[model samples]
Target chain A: MSRATILSAILSNQPQTTQLPEDLQFDCPAKAAVTEKFIQMINLIGGRVVEIQRIEDINLYATAHYGAGERLITPIEELDFYTQFAGDEDPHQFENIAFAVFKTHFAVAENGAVWITEDRMGARVLPFICQHLGMLVFEDSIVSNMHEAYQLIGSQDYGFGTFIAGPSKTADIEQSLVLGAHGARSIIIFLLKKEL
Target chain B: MSSIKHPELSDIFNKDEERVNWHDDTLWWIRAKRDKAAHGISEWELLRETASQIKNNVLSNLHNYLIEFEEKAQKNGIKVHWAANAEEHNKIVLSLLQGKGINQMVKSKSMLTEECHLNEYLESNGIDVIDSDLGERIVQLAKEPPSHIVLPCIHKKKEEIGQLFHEHLGTEAGISDPQVLTETARIHLRKTFLTRRSALTGVNFAVAETGEFVVCTNEGNADMGAHLADIHIACMGIEKLIPKKKHLSVFLRLLTRSATGQPITTYSSHFKKPRKGQEMHIVLVDNGRSVQLGREDFRNSLKCIRCGACMNTCPVYRRSGGHSYHNAIAGPIGAILAPNLDMKEYADLPFASTLCGSCTNVCPVKIDIHDQLYKWRQVIVKEGYTSSAKTVAMKVMDFTLSSPTRFKLAGKIGRWTLKHAPFTVNNRLNLWFKNREMPEAPEESFSEWYKRNNSI
Candidate 1:
């Protein structure tokens, strides 16, 4: 009758599987090249990219901004950088930019999409909070559907994850399709080369 | 305990039948949009069938799956609570807020909350609950219940909303522009979103496998409120659960298309875990669902996704207006479901529909709404709850029809009386004839004509 007792009964009946795919492998060497290609793709989509270095953290960073006619960037290394840009601190700081491109574990070249799990963004809110969000996908991890992609990251723990297709869009207002409403204005897929 | 029902609203509608025509046309336009969006996908029907079956399986195994969902949600640092009824659900939420020492909260549109009158209850307890959705906010300010679930202020014109905003929000008077009025509300609600320490939203779908709840919205208000708040409470009916994530793909594909004819809602935020400094709670409310679920004829009503497609496509709903049902939910779907909550109290609702069957056709989950309404009528009538006048009339008709001699004599008398006294039969005393003209008495009854034409 207790909730725990019922849950145990349900889980006991479930079939559990833990098998890894042969082709599903992470390539750590492509990280830098993927970052560059991501920047190029953002530029190609009419976004401005700015590179900055932090002396205290000893890390390089870049931020891309696109919305209206303004292009602003926040360094990737800084904490709460996106929030500051998104005007969490000030209510008047609403920007007309599309999305922010971030480096991710891997990219699926098959669909020209990027993989950003909840772990990298710290929260699922980040990807949706921006107007347009772009993720750097390494050439190796792209697959046809979610089923194949899940098999690659076998047994890896994550809080949450999602496969975003494109820019935030809706046709609900008046049946006229508007690409951007609250979240990312547009999503640009950056397909990085094999070598950095 | 009988309050005088507002006969004037019904009277006004009766006088201006054109308003019903306009209302029907508006809802039909949205129905057409749904059809267009649904037909574009090749696997649309298959997806609906799968979603329906998945929900059916979950309902059949609900006791087990609910336990699974609660356990996984608790493991993810989300607290879960159960309420046997609406009062209990509101009490649990208030208790949670009292424990947090919070007094103010912002809420996204939740029909479950509306059914429970949670805002009025919370305010009675001295807590300020602000409605963040534009449509809900309009109706909230008016101190009136929402006429439609999806479009809460659908019955009101922009001019009325402009006046309300100007009076309450200090906007320039005489400005009826939607864009300007909407922007004003957006800015006003943005302040509430930032200051409110707690937020409440409705659960569209809860995946039993992952222990996650999905809340869909157009303005992203639900997400904004939840993400910014210290405490996020999601109120869901017990029937919202689905068995797996793959099942969500099927539902998500059909829900928006059926509800508003959109490819997808603007925001479909999945809440799985409580963020770093926030707390999450889910209250599963079962006010009258368990009792309804036990009824074999009406249990399928539980499968409804609250898409409002049924209402949009329902001809009777558009003409009668939602307020006619006098329940938290309205329209054809509401007619069937409301009676199950309180058969005597909501008896009029079930008889409100014309049994056209358009609602079932447009239903994304296929609930057989009109059939259920018809069934409720029979149940109500059998319970001796029919009005005294109607009961007497039915008895007289039964007596006359059961005897051929009595029927023939009654028919001849009726014709003679009608022909002699037209004004008496076609007066205001007969409310049915108020808007209709009575046909002149035939020269002879149909049976009399038949007897003369052929051997009887």
Candidate 2:
């Protein structure tokens, strides 16, 4: 079998094994200002952040920011203005969604990315097919760097998960940045101060 | 029956001086962005070292990790396939598509697939593959291969791209705006993403601990295609496997910053298992990687994460363009890796470099790219893959330099020729004079002047 042949080949040619580094810990002096750094990074990456005192404020924020003509879909029950989408549907059905407001497990401060899984998204394509994406992340759930983020997500089970830092963009044409190549054009993160 | 080498191909690329300058400046700008992003983190060097050590551990015990990954992925309800070569990989994909009765598929940027020539193989088998990445799609429309790994169409100007879109995508002529052209591609590819039953992506890193793989993209086209499709197929080289999921932190931190100077790619999507009612398949392809692993000097080349940092920092790559390397993966990394696959075919690639060591310094995993380039040149020459002229030239150089008298005589003759008949050394016939002017010859040699002036 090719598997056996390939495996044997690799094993035969193996170099002396070196034990993995003992300490994976990295100390970042900027940990105290993770939130401030997170916001700065988000702005630089073309993502917007709105601080809300309560999760219920998302409804008013959605209406005030997106207006009535926009089609809103969310898994969060607190946002009454947005329609709660069914978990089961053809991915293509959500192609024209104007806004997708979903809850992220946690947010990484170093890169301004929120971790979301397929279960939270209802449909896998909801986050990408939508014209805009709005993520609800608790302020306390933010980690300082990717290392902390991974530590928090140790051995977690999920079919699909992603660390979405910003909206879809490209610089393919003469290296000029263009937003909304094939995914959401704009991503707005709503930071909820209260616990879920 | 014709085989052209790197020099001949680069000559063609250098025909347009303006394009060459634009390509060089654009890549250098990206390199500068990488510098800024790398500088943002205080422990960037520490992070690179940690990542390099982690890769070393993985490489030493790769067979174990691959097995563990395959076992865990299979247990997670994700199908795992192993291919000895590109042909087997392509056949596995074809059978999967055929079983599902799918005629077309959408593929994100996968240099592995490109190396396998999967698109052409599938097309020959009557399967239509649509490239979804904006840069990749631009090259696909132009009916050409990607020049750079990260920026596939970096060799193309906006006007040329506009013309390509105008001809292939039916956009208005003379429309060179990136926004309009990108939007046109977005609308055009959305239909393909929605309709295609299967999506193929290149795996950036596969974790053995959690049985998951990650695909990073700035445009989010990989997510759009994979999430929307019913089946997702990820192909990776055997060297892409990491020991654990936590290793991702170091690799991801270093990946985008080194590639395009971004803090991180826009989307770093992880696939642990198949989505509900959908199928996910991971193919581990050897395709001469095992042979590369057996070679000690070149095994470090497998540590590359396909970030294209070396290509951006490469002076030759920037000036001659990525296509000049004439391989699926080009630039400094490609030059070393290509010769391992085919010595005779890519013998010229190793010599294409100037050994400035910039590529090695910029490498995220510290591949020792320039050192490997030097080694490959020796290997190629030893294997008799070099041209006869170069071999003869080396022999004459050795005969003259090995003897003191012959060296002194040769130096005298060379200086005399340069001083007396300057035109003999400063003409088109002289390869060195092609792009440079001959230096002035002094009346006396430095050694001669030193001997005459010394009283002791």
> Each model's C-alpha lDDT?
0.68, 0.90
Candidates in order: C-alpha RMSD to true structure: 8.0, 1.7
lDDT of 1 by residue, B156-250 (tens): 66778889999999999998777667667766876787688899999998977778888887666687678768899999998899876556556
Docking level of model 2:
high
Model 2 segments more than 4 A misplaced: A28-32, A67-69, A81-86, A194-196, B1-4
- A1-196, model 1: which lDDT tens digit per residue? 1334434433443223222111212333353554554455344323333332322221122232323454433324443334333222322233333345555655332222344555565444556555556555544444432234445544344554444544544332223244543446566555444443
Tens digit per residue, CA lDDT, model 2, A1-196: 5899899999998788988865467665354477788888899999999998888878887777676777788877777855555655778888778888999999888888899988798788889999998999887788888998899888888988999998999998989999998989999999877544
Question: What's model 2's lDDT at B78?
Answer: 93
- Distance from true position, residue B385, model 1, in Å? 2.3
Q: What is the lDDT of residue A50 in candidate 2?
A: 92
Tell me which residue pairs clash in candidate 2: none
lDDT of 2: 0.90
DockQ of each: 0.11, 0.82
Model 1 CAPRI quality: incorrect
